[model samples]
Structures are given as structure tokens and as C-alpha cells.
Target: MDDAASIDGDTTRPLSQAELDALTDQLIDKLKTVFDPEIPVDIYELGLVYKVDVSDDKDVAIDMTLTAPGCPVAGDMPGWVEQAVMEIPGVRSCKVDLVFDPPWDPSRMSDEAKLQLNMF
Candidate 1:
């Protein structure tokens, strides 16, 4: 193992672009671990997350939304997403952008999410 790997006690090789993409996916997965207190499905599956951008410096920017314009957790979900992104090993920073442009509807949810929520 190399010095950095040894220091981290990780045996995996340094990540390439594909590996980094995988890490980004894993980071997204971690973000999904959190859920809207009122909803059974993850925000990711709910299509609340519109975009995830990772910069060259490993900073992450998330554009997300709530289930409704006046949801109770509106003030907190972005912070939750920020916290989740920051947990990624190489993430230097996280910025959450809360949006309502397209607005949220049941149709935005993933098929699995709809199935889980029995919306379908």
C-alpha cells in the first residue's frame, strides 16, 4: 500500500475518473440515507434532487427541492444534504441550492419511489 493509503488504512488503489464517478454515486447513495420526516421514500427517489455537481477540487453542489412549497422541513433539508455531501472522503465543500422552478408533484418521483409509496 502507498503512503496515503497506509495513512488512511485503505487498501484500494487511488481512484480514477470512473472510480471517482463511483464515489460520487456512493455519495449520492449516502445522501439518500436521509429521508423527509413525513415521507417514507428518500428525497433522491422522490426527485427532489435535481442536480449534483462535483468540481475539480471535490466540492459538491446540490440543487434540490421539497415535496411542496410549504413543507415543514423546507428550512432544514438543504442543510441535511450539505452534511451528507461533506461526509464524502474528498469532498472539500458542499453547497445546497433549494429551488422551486418546476415545482414538485407526484409525477416527479421515481418508479420505485412511487411503488414504495403506493402512489402508482
Candidate 2:
């Protein structure tokens, strides 16, 4: 996913669909590295990530949530996610927002996460 918007000289242009797609893949890969600490699966697979938006300058905004409102690491997980996303080369900035609008449910977990947790 390092290939996303990795232009040689001009980086000020608005992201093309291809660049956005590649950047999205990179973002997902980075998100996959962040875990809930208590869960064996990463946050991405757990479906904690709600939305991701990338700016023309490569700034990233993410909306995510916890499995439970009272989760202990609630104070630290967003920072972890932001840090991970910032590791991408072309990313100028990263911001992670915690949201509970729809809340989280086991139904949100990916098939791989379900298999990992034996939810099936």
C-alpha cells in the first residue's frame, strides 16, 4: 500500500481515483495493525473502523468505535490508530475520531475475525 499517491515531484494535485484507491488500501493495511488489546483480532477486522477520508494533501480522517463504551483502553486506542496511519509515507496528517452513533455489534466483524473468534 506504500504506492498510494507516491508521486515523484508534484504532490499538490487532487488525488485521482486510482490514488485514492491505493491510499485506501494502505490505510486499511495500517488500521489492521491496531488491536483492541483484549481481542485477538485487529481493529480493522473487528469492524471498529467506521469511515476513512483522505484529503488532497494526504491528510487522513478516521471514524472508529470501541466494542464497549467502558472499554479500558478507550483513552489510548485512537492515538494508536492515528499513529499507525501516520506511518504511511505520503500521509501528511492523521486524525482519528471516536464515534458511537450506530455502536458496535458482533455482526460488524469480518468473516476472518469471526473465524478467529469462532463466532461461526
Candidate 3:
């Protein structure tokens, strides 16, 4: 239980390495639960999730993009991601940002996603 003391009774300090690692794993697990409606694979595997940043206070910020900027679910997918992130027990907040600078391409996808999509 002591090892789980993320706050260490001081919220101002940064989370320990172990805490960060655990939280990161949990965040990825949560992110993997969110999916693009049109895609059978989760957004994480699809490479839609560009970045995930966690603040000292356990706030999560995500940068993600869609298969296409005009995709039908663009407006709702971020919320789905936020919902998934907020499910983590220790997460204090979640924010999802949609970005398009480096537009999505097949190259970003994981091998598993490629296999699932039959993109071999």
C-alpha cells in the first residue's frame, strides 16, 4: 500500500517513476478501449493516438487524429477517448486534442492493426 502512495501526501511533487510507468500502462489500456466507429481496431493500434502526456496531478492530455479529417465521428471520438481515460481510478482529469499537422497515413499503424485491416 505504501508503494501505491502516488501523492506521497504532497500533490505538488511529480509522480515517481514507478507511478508514471503504472499510469502510462493504465492510460494505454484505457486508450485501447476506444475505437473509431468505422474501424474494427482500437484507435491506439490504428495510430490515431499521436501523443499521451500525463501531468503531475494525474491529468491526461492526448493528441490524436482521424483516418480522414472529414470523418463522420470526428466530433465524438475525442469524447469517447476522454471517457475511456477518465475510467482510470487515479486519473484526475482527461483532455483529448485533435491534430492534423502530420496527417494520418497507413505508415503509422501497428503491425497488429495492419494485420487486422488486412493491409499486409
Candidate 4:
């Protein structure tokens, strides 16, 4: 993931649907590397990531939540996510928005995440 990228000397053009999908996949892979401080599972599998949006200009936006509002890393998790996403190629910028609405629950966890935590 590099911060410097341009397509044909233009960075404002919207990406094609296929291009967006491919970039999204890459973004997910990068996101899977971030882990909750207390959880062995990555944030993606842990269900912290609620939404990922990519704009025409390749800007990235993430909507996410924490395991708990009182979690020690509450102040830093968003930045961590932003940094991770910003590292991806073609990502012009990244913004992570933390939200507790529709609050996180065990049901949100991926099957793999549940298995890893022995929640089954």
C-alpha cells in the first residue's frame, strides 16, 4: 500500500465497477491485518468493520465500531484502520468513522471469528 498513485496522470476520475470491486478486495485484505488488542481475531472477522465505501476518486471511507465503548484503544482504533486502508494502492485518502449505532454484538462475528474464540 503506497500513498502515491495516479492513473494516466489523472486522479479524479471515477473507477469502473470492476476496478472498484478489485480495489475493495484489496482493501479487505489489508483490513484483515488489523486486530483488536484483546482479540486474537482480526477486526474484519471480529465484526468491527460495519461498512467500507469507495468514492469515484478512490477515496476510502470506513464505518466501524469497537467491542466496547470503554475499550482501551477506542481513541486509536480508527486511526489504525485509516492507516491500514491508506496504505493500499489507488487509495487517495482514507477516513474511518466510528459508530456505535446498531451496536456490535456476538451475532456480527464471522463464523471463523466465532470458531477462533470458541464462541460456538
TM-score of 1: 0.82
63 Cα displacement, candidate 1 (Å): 0.6
Which stretches of model 4 miss by more than 4 angstroms?
Answer: 1-11
Please identify model 3 stretches exceeding 4 Å from their true place: 1-11
Q: Estimate, for each residue in 1-120, the C-alpha lDDT of model 1 and write its tens digit.
A: 243344255343445799678877887787788798898989988889988887655667888888888999999888888888788777779999999988988888899998998886
Rank all candidate structures by their lDDT, best first, as comma-separated numbers.
Answer: 2, 3, 4, 1
Question: Sort by TM-score, best first: what order?
Answer: 3, 2, 4, 1
Give the per-residue lDDT digits (tens) of candidate 4, residues 16-71: 78998899889989889999989999999999999988888778889999999899
Colliding pairs, model 2: none
All candidates: TM-score: 0.82, 0.89, 0.90, 0.88
lDDT of each: 0.82, 0.92, 0.90, 0.88
Residue-level lDDT for 30 in candidate 3:
88
- The TM-score measured for candidate 2 stands at 0.89
lDDT of 1 at 74: 92
Best by TM-score: 3
How do the residues 9-96 of candidate 3 rate in per-residue lDDT, one tens digit apiece? 6635668899999999998898899888898999999999999999878889999999999999999999999998999998999999
Instruction: Please give the RMSD of candidate 1 to the true structure.
Output: 6.5
C-alpha positional error of residue 44 in candidate 3 after TM-score superposition, expressed in Å: 0.2
Tens-digit per-residue lDDT, 1-120, candidate 2: 344354576546678899999998999999999999999999999999999989889889999999999999999999999999999998999888999989999999999999999999
Residue pairs with backbone atoms closer than 3 Å in model 1 (clashes): none
